[model samples]
Target: MTTAIRRRGPDADGAWVDTDRGVALGHRRLSIIDLSPGGAQPMESADGRYVIVYNGEIYNFADLRADLEAAGQAPGWRGHSDTEVLLAALSAWGLDRTLAALNGMFAFALWDRAEGRLSLARDRMGEKPLYHGWVGQGEQRTLLFASDLAALHAHPAFRPEIDPASVSQLLRFGHVPDPASVYRGVGKLAPGTRLTLSADGGEDAFVYWDTLSEYARAAGEARFRGDAIEAVDELERLLGNAVLRQSVADVPLGSFLSGGIDSSAVTALLQHNASGPVKSFSIGFSESAYDESPHARAVAAHLGTDHQELIVTPEDALAVIPDLPGIYSEPFADSSQIPTYLVARMAREQVTVALSGDAGDELFAGYNRHVHAHRSWPRLARIPRPLRRLAGRAMTAVSPARWDAAIGPLVARKAVGVGEKMHKAAGVIASRDGDALYATLISVNPDFRELLRHPSEKDGFEGRALEIVAGLPLPDRMMAMDAIHYLPGDILTKVDRAAMAVSLETRVPMLDVDVIRFAWSLPADMKLRDGVSKWPLREMLYRHVPRQLIERPKQGFGVPIHDWLRGPLREWAEGLLFDSAASLDEYFDRPAIAALWQRHLSGAGNHQHRLWPILMFQAWRARS
Candidate 1:
């Protein structure tokens, strides 16, 4: 099983087992810190009661070590890896305090001989992954888990039953939400949680941290009393410190720069904190609409950093499509995964560790969808539900182009791409209430149930997010949901998988503990001021990078998925839906998929979001 994930850790491999105790631990080491053999795992503690096989860096290990020494809990020293520090901390502080003191990204499993139990834990913000399940039934039932699904699947006892409901969720949300993998009876561990299993077949689970509750607590403490400048100053200092902590690596380190507010700010801060020129990576395309390399290059030049870039062609992207199944090792539908993989591949050629600016959009109100939906919902809600539904039906009754030509100049302030915006609004205009409205706005296909043969019930993290963000203002509520749901499930998963596929490590400093708390305390106006998104991030970044370079409209870091589905990928897609229809026959309604594909092909509607997940699911099924 450990050999299956050799790519995640090319530096070393080890295993520890005690047949009498009925427990085993395996590790594949990436060897980022303490290159000596002393830092290797599966490690044994000084007291010999605890054993741990850990993945990911503990950024606060040095502080923890110091605290232990001060408290007279320190053991004789070993090499300086975070793994050793973690084991020692566990011995001194026990599971709960050691976990609570951690300030990093990780997922780990620890065995306790004294208690005759095993514990699994994940990091606070879900930066890393851990999947677990019972491999069998009766007295033979065995608990199994690993950092990647491929490792778990390689086990002889592994069961690979497809969960149809999760497939329906993939069609709706692009990625399956957490606590539910595509495989039945296997679950991705939730962020800020731990589960303990004992020799008697009893189970216990606990949440060590809670993102939504913590944010609410921080916000309720008090709004920031300072003005914009003070907020920006504090953000820059906190973000710079985060970069410094993550940069403590024995291997080469760099960052991904799209020249957006988030990436540019991280790059600038990293360069400031570095002793020499920081290494930066980016990827570009021929299609200018999706390219950000030119802007990234400009930022790198001004920051005086070593920059690397690749000009990706259509063939390069097409080559990655066939490998997505094996790479992700599960069904995932985010189209940006292609470009993300390309950039990570490029960066791995130069550096072993990379930093990313991912969570800024979730922490601040950076998404136009969230902002526009928040703005438009109130006015639409004032109208009666039936009238709103009627208005939505009338708006989408005609083709978007016909709508544009028919009512293009009627409004006082004509909306850009007025027809597209109107049609999007129509999807949520008739929602039953505010919560339902937000759910519809974020879904790829709000009519997802109609596509499934046995829709059954959702029973995933989707409902958890909606419940958490219940009565806050729409913009903040959406931001909280994105931070809680979309950030870990989609954005962070994309970064982690794409980077780890090639043995490179990526960190997101925007999700730092201090940064998150500060983000929550600032009023929404500070984030989305005067109709501009990420206002505080913009203010902080402008001081380092010229405002001219940083103030452009936000372009998504994604591929031209829609055009490709209709053009380059059409034949490949047909082979899955039409030729190999067995998976669809068993789980989904092939006729609905065929009608949607036909409608997209004929330009009747743009169903790219809907079709992409179906294609991804089919591709994963065919490969796995």
Candidate 2:
């Protein structure tokens, strides 16, 4: 199992087993913080009761160590590694307390030999991945866990059985949510959760921390009472501390600079704190509309950092498609995964660790959906339900192309393709309520039921939708919903897998617990103000770089998948859809799939979003 995931930690590997206790632990080391052999894992404690095989870095380990020393709890450490401090802290303060004090990304397994118990835990925001489950039955049952699905596949006792419900989730959201894996029986451990198994085969799983609960607590108690300037200053201070903590590492480190609010903000802080110029990396495209390298270059020049940029052609991006299935190990249809992988690869060439400006969108109201919900939902809700339905139907009566042509001259041009935006807007108008409306807006395949051969047995969102902040405005609700769902499930997963594929560790300072709490405490207007999203974040960026260099329509990190499907990838897509149309019938409606592919090829409409998920699923299925 450990060998299967050598890509994640190519530096070193180790394993420990206790035959009498019927237990074993394994680790593949990346050797980021401490380079000596003393930093190796499955690391054991001084008293020899606890042993752990951990993944990820502890950014605040130095401060934690200082606190322990001042309190006279520090053991004569063998080396200066976060792993050693973590073990000592676990011994000193116990599991729950140690987890609460941690402010870094991690997923680990700790075994208590004296108590004959094994515990598994993930970080507060699901930045690192962990999967666990029991195999066999009764007396023969065995529990298995790993950092990635490929490792689980390597276990001799593991069985691979597709979970239809997970497939439904992939089609619905473009990625499966937590507590469910692509395979039956096995499950991805939820973020901020811990699972402990006893010698008797009994188990317990509980949340050590939760983003929803934190948001609720902050909403009820930690509401930001300061004015705009105070809020921005406080935000900058929190962000600076977060970045400084993450910047601690033994090896070379840098930040991904996309010139967007999030990445640019992280880069600015990193450079501000670094004694030398911070190393920065970005990936660009020859395709003008899809490129953001110019902005990134301007930011790097202003920040006076050592910057690296790679301009990839369509062929360079297309070359990554064949490896996506294995790299992700599940059906993830986020097209941005391509650019993320390319950028990660570029960073890997110069640095061992990189900080990203992820979670800023989720923390603050940065998604277009949040704005759409805020601007359109109130007006739509005022209309009677029947009248709204009539309007929605009328909007759909005219094809998206006709709507675009009719409104093109009257309204200003949008960043998104007019036809695609109009079609999506129709879906929003057709929603029945907030939950349905948010789901429609986020869904890549809203009519997944029509595409599948059988009804999904598992309810979407696990029988209930998110209602973290019940009484908040529509925008806040949407932002909170995404924080709990989309941010960790899709965005974090994509970055984690893509970066780890090349043995590079990516950290998100924006998701620091303090940052999350503070962002949620502010009123919705503070986040999205005067028709601009991520207002406070922009304020911070403007402090470091001029607004003109960064201000523009938000161009998401994306590849030109729509153009590729019609041009370079048409043959490959057709073979997967048409050549195997009958074979795919067991899972999909062949005729429906064929029609969608034909329409996309004929340019009737841009069906890339819908088709991408199906293609990803098929690609993964073939590899599995």
The per-prediction CA RMSD against the true structure, in angstroms, equals 2.5, 1.7
TM-score list, all predictions: 0.96, 0.97
lDDT of 2 at 192: 91
lDDT of 1 by residue, 1-624 (tens): 999999999999999999887788999999899999999899999889899999899987899989989999988888888888899899988999889899899999999989998999999889999999988778778889999999988888897998887888898888888988989999999999999998887889999998777766666665577898999999898888888888899999999998888999999999987889999999999877688889999999999999999999988999999999888888888999999999999999999999999999888888886667556677878899999899889988887656656676885331334565678778778788776776777787777777778885763445665566565677777777777678888999988998999999999898888788888888877787887888888988888999998877667888877778889999999898888554677877889888988987876666777888888889999988
The per-prediction tally of clashing pairs is: 0, 0
User: What lDDT does candidate 1 reach at residue 593?
Assistant: 83
Q: Encode model 2's per-residue lDDT on 84-203: one tens digit a residue.
A: 999999999999999999988999999998888999999998999998888887876888899899988887778898888888888888999886888999899989999988988688
Can you give the lDDT of residue 47 in candidate 1?
A: 88
Predicted structure 2: lDDT: 0.87
